[model samples]
Target chain A: MIDSGIRLPWNRRLKLLIAYDGSSFSGWQRQKHDRTIQGEIEKCLSIMTNEDIFLHGAGRTDGGVHAEGMVAHFDCSSRIPDQNFMRGLNSMLPGAIRILDTNTCDPSFHARFSAIGKKYHYTVFTGKVHPPRIRLYSHHVTAPLNLATINSCLQAVVGTHDFSSFENSGSRDKSLTGGRGAVRTIYSARLLQQDKDCLVFEFIGDGFLKNMVRNLVGTILEAGRGKFDAEQFAAILAAKDRSSGGPTAPPQGLFLKQVFYQDRTLDHCISGKD
Target chain B: MIDSGIRLPWNRRLKLLIAYDGSSFSGWQRQKHDRTIQGEIEKCLSIMTNEDIFLHGAGRTDGGVHAEGMVAHFDCSSRIPDQNFMRGLNSMLPGAIRILDTNTCDPSFHARFSAIGKKYHYTVFTGKVHPPRIRLYSHHVTAPLNLATINSCLQAVVGTHDFSSFENSGSRDKSLTGGRGAVRTIYSARLLQQDKDCLVFEFIGDGFLKNMVRNLVGTILEAGRGKFDAEQFAAILAAKDRSSGGPTAPPQGLFLKQVFYQDRTLDHCISGKD
Candidate 1:
């Protein structure tokens, strides 16, 4: 039975933590005529449990990006098992999609609206060439990357800013189509080594605009590769121009690290902060 | 350069510790007719380095049997830098095969004949049902397994004996065809668990006869499933008849764990005294 005390006939809300390899997906959101992660998940759920599920994810990732701690929410009929909910969903999803954890949360807790923080990581592989085994998980950089130069530029992006300089221009304007706001806050950012030849750029924030993290990664990489100095990063901030950012990094290297909320107990994650 | 220590102008020997998914591979050894891991590696090397090669392996794993630390040796004309050996080999191999470690071992080191100890692991997920994500790596035993009774039966396979009973009756008998002696020593055999649902049966030995480990795993599994009495394993060994043996386990749940040597620095492994 679900967590509702008056079990057996009413709708019960549940939170699910998910992970997926996004190579074959268009994005997280569903479209009328496209292959998306949300579309596949909902289709599978409709077949397995015989319910029309409207799954809401914390963020929308582009094609070929990955997710290790994506947060989603859906409601189901009263027949769902509380302890084995994750087990049942995992049995129906494809190998690339996995439900890491699940729990019952307050009905008011929405995955997209209630999320307090989100984290993302961008992977970069070093060396003069690439390895085929790791090519799927990292972006290969032929030029030498200095960590100190990139770290200096990341320091400027660590606080609240308009962030209009680091995102797709059309998406940023589209988000404010209904006379809304466009400012957001960044908490922390750092880089890590995932393997011998691969490095990761990680960012944690209250929220992000479209393509903001990828744009920031490409900017820092330009500084690391000696194409620009930290002064250029500062100049880009002053200009508030999307074209000031470097080339967009590939989608294969980006990962949704985590999503945070107060009510969901299944928010604990292994890859990033919750 | 070879074990002879003479500078050979046309050849360079390379030794690699390899890992693979094995789900889409034919086997480790190359056949004149079939597409196998070794065959593909040779083909890719020929294309990349523009040289012919003869691939050698530590053991012949069956189709769908994975390898985490399988040792292999090959000779080619391209004199790759010692530092770039792993990266270069991995660039040519398929996504499923990865060269974990690479070294320039002596020509005298035949991966198969000149071996000391080898370890193999078989994973069993015991419960009423198992999660589909972990299903490829483990065997599902729907029936209850008695650990204590199964442990007792493992003792019967610890010493040197005529393993004719464990051999697959349908297999090509290398023992009858002037092969190495079938009597080999089992150094260690026990069940290991890294997680709750994942139970691993590890066997360390000098060498294994064709289908010996799978048959051994099947017999012990029968005891674990309570299908055969605990004492029946000893009777099965004494019968020295293939008909008395249990069923051969599926290759999907098996992995070549490691090939051990007396010293990691040496180019060759010490042969087993037994």
Candidate 2:
């Protein structure tokens, strides 16, 4: 402590708030051959810091799934200012991905492990003619839907329950305590009318299984179309079997809107309501 | 008294409300060697009707300029219903363009000549880190700007005035009664704070010269940055010289929002505020 001249490792941990269109990305993971959100960001960080860097995202969004407030963390030894990270990464990243904000964080702040909650949004275009400008960001449903029916179906999705029926087969592990980890808590499920032609479904949950949001939306949509009555929807959830749920909706309409942490200092990054 | 059996050439004039993300288009006009909005639509119509079709758009948006409600008209002898045109054209056209609505119009109706007014929108992203998802639709301006100063500049842009200083030199015509035709009426000009980081400039006018809206935004931005005072901006407008105005803003931030026609029947097309 007396020798102030001695140099110390920067040993700084950085957090990043990222946004992407997801039209061209394969997914959020780092794949050897496929283009991905994590792969792209790591490449840019490597170039900027001149060192191999690795990133851990809050969630692994599938291909064609967008994110507005996806949180990530990386450890770096570079002595550059925090602002430079934002500028340098954005300058090197593709036009489809952006570093919305950057900040230095506590070394113990893990992107995935310390996360407390997540919010997902799915958009459905209910217009007669879907606009080309938003085709990649919304699911076009030309069939008229009964909103009241869909809202009732959503009520059956909230609360702590076994959501095995909503999980995709590929993500299931029967060996994990006999599939006891399939339980998750949903705090709120809302259907917001963004405009005359757009309906946004928002789900805030303590956790989500693979393909859970899309499958839930698919089940609710079927109810809206009058294919399944309210009683049948409850029965599907109670079955706890994958075959009991509807088909998974397309991935293009799904978005990881926000990742919540315990500190809540990063809440400013989540701007604007859907 | 008319003969219903014989079709009088079917001489039906149809008007279409189109929306497009112009990132992939060369412009609204048809160029022999470029992909354009008009060229793509006309080609689709030709394939569907098996006839050479010509289209007239309300405005010729430059390359990279988007449109939310651009209007166009075409004449066809095909006896298909109006709904078919909307479905057929959309099915054949590329994903960047969409036909929102289609209807048969009076033979006297024209897309450009009959337009009584037009509205254009320019978006400027004032955030420190520009979101890549909106890079093609907004201009990135990181400099802090004064909203009061910009609003004062915009106040001077409204009302009738000679806009020669705002027009691009290539679009100017000195032979039109010694450039007297440059005088046009601006109905309203508004600077909207879309969010904490986005500023939208909306211009409504009876007519606008080429590059007028972009140039006006450029000038207003300069004033917002304290580059010029409100007096200097008013002086620039009065100068009536192209060199007196600020540089023309980039085309990517520009949008043809809507076109107003004298027939109140078309008023329904312009719904919702900016």
Candidate 3:
């Protein structure tokens, strides 16, 4: 008995490119009380569509961690045009969060599962006095860092290895359930001089465990400051024990730059214009 | 007949290079009821030295206007070292303002009167949607602008001219007191592409009348949008009437980059690293 009048549910998968300051957000995850990126977006989308919409983000960035090109997606029953969805969502969202772009994507395009790799940047301002203008965007390190040492240490970080030492304990249980161990492939790692006093550390990898990027930056900074040598850093990585690594760097200095997918089509969709 | 014990005062003039996020400040001038850059600095200095300290800024930036290298000077009778002055002021001042560098300068060094030239930059974000991260630092213009047209129009603005048309009414009274007319020399004017969607208008001139930079940016943006041809823009300048010019642009996009002094010794004081 086919109910012909029960019109087939019209569903569309919408992908969004989002950017947020993260200074005011608890994180990307939705929480009942805390203000979060995902919570804010979902609340706005639900009001706009009159349906409870859940957002799936590529990465769950921690509090005080910013994003320039975070990817997310959701299924919507409403037939809102792509451009209108972007404009509507942005208008409803707070000034701290923004939907940079919106597009219709294949149903199978999952923001998290389909992601192949991700890139992150950590900025450090080594000026004598931290400039007030960039205080939120960068970490202030009054001590000058040796760039040559930092670059040399990065060379050792650019390869497949078990990054358990770099992962915080909170994410260990989740990694264990996957049964793939803590081994992850790092495609590249490099140190960039943003200006005379700002140093940027960029990492591109297959995946990152919670606090992995921050921990790596902290450890690398130690080597840059001659607190430890590259050999000692390599030894810490081989230990695979969190206690063997340096302290996790502050969250404010970290930024999730972009998430990459295997589909070449999605690459072009990520606006290279910005 | 001076008391021998009351030695002649050794007042040291200290120059400070400051940077501030103007979002929270009323302006650079000292106001009785409003929070301002000068007022904040004076309060902090008064607390530190128990003496009334007055700061003379290189430019009296309007509300919501930012500065990267604003120079200011104050006479200090307390024998505090230059480094200690910087550290003490920063420790007491709010996080929104910071002293980038501090040095003892010649007593004749006046932040305003000693300046021979100044540079200001106005940033416009021409992206489809303004990224929330840079909203306070740049003006968001959704429509695409023709850079070539803007550059061509800038050619007409490079030389010295009577900028009366671009001066706002609030500043007209001050300009009239000079009796030299509204004639001012513009050393250079150019359009710079900061990134894919960020256009930066850089203006280097002997001095700028109040609201002159904002008005010029407004008129130049109109020319970029093809609202008025280059010849019309030239005529607007020739008209020497405020009503003939475009509306004054908003204050958020304006930044006082540097103030140059004619003295070769002071010239070296400007940080060229940035």
lDDT of 3 by residue, B1-274 (tens): 7665633246879899998889879999999899999999989988887888988898788899999889999997977778888999899988779998888898989988788888899999998777777888899887668777888878888888999999876654464336756888877788778899899998888788889999999998998888988889999999999899998888999998888876453334323323
Task: Report lDDT per candidate.
Answer: 0.76, 0.86, 0.85
Per-residue CA lDDT of model 1 for A1-274, tens digit only, reads 5566735436778788888878778878898898888888888767756878888888788888888889888887746675577777677777677777887777898998888888788999886445443456678787888888898888878777777778786664454333334467777777777676788887877788888888888888989999988888878866767777777788878989778774343234323444
Query: What TM-score would you give candidate 1 relative to the actual structure?
Result: 0.75
Task: Please tell me which predicted candidate would have the highest DockQ against the true structure.
Answer: 2
Cα lDDT of model 1 by residue, B155-263, tens digit: 7777777787888766654654345445777766777775777778878877777888889988888888888876888888888888899988888789887887654
- Most lDDT-accurate candidate: 2
Q: Candidate 3: where is the Cα deviation over 4 Å?
A: A1-9, A172-177, A263-274, B1-9, B171-177, B263-274
Question: Which lDDT tens digits does candidate 2 get at residues A139-200?
Answer: 98888899988988888888999998898977744573335578988877888799998999
Best by TM-score: 2
Q: Any idea what lDDT model 1 has?
A: 0.76
The sequence of per-residue lDDT tens digits that candidate 2 reaches over residues B1-274 is 9766745348889999999989989999999999999999999998887889999898788899999889999998887778988999988988789998999899999998788888899999998767756788899888889898898888998899999899987764456333458898887788878898999998888788988999999888998888998889999999999899998899889988889886353333333333
Task: Please write out the lDDT profile of model 3 over residues A124-181, one tens digit for every residue.
Answer: 9998777777788898888667778888878888889999889898665564336767
Tell me model 3's lDDT, rounded to 2 decimals.
Answer: 0.85
- Model 1 residue B124 lDDT score: 87
lDDT of 2 at B105: 92
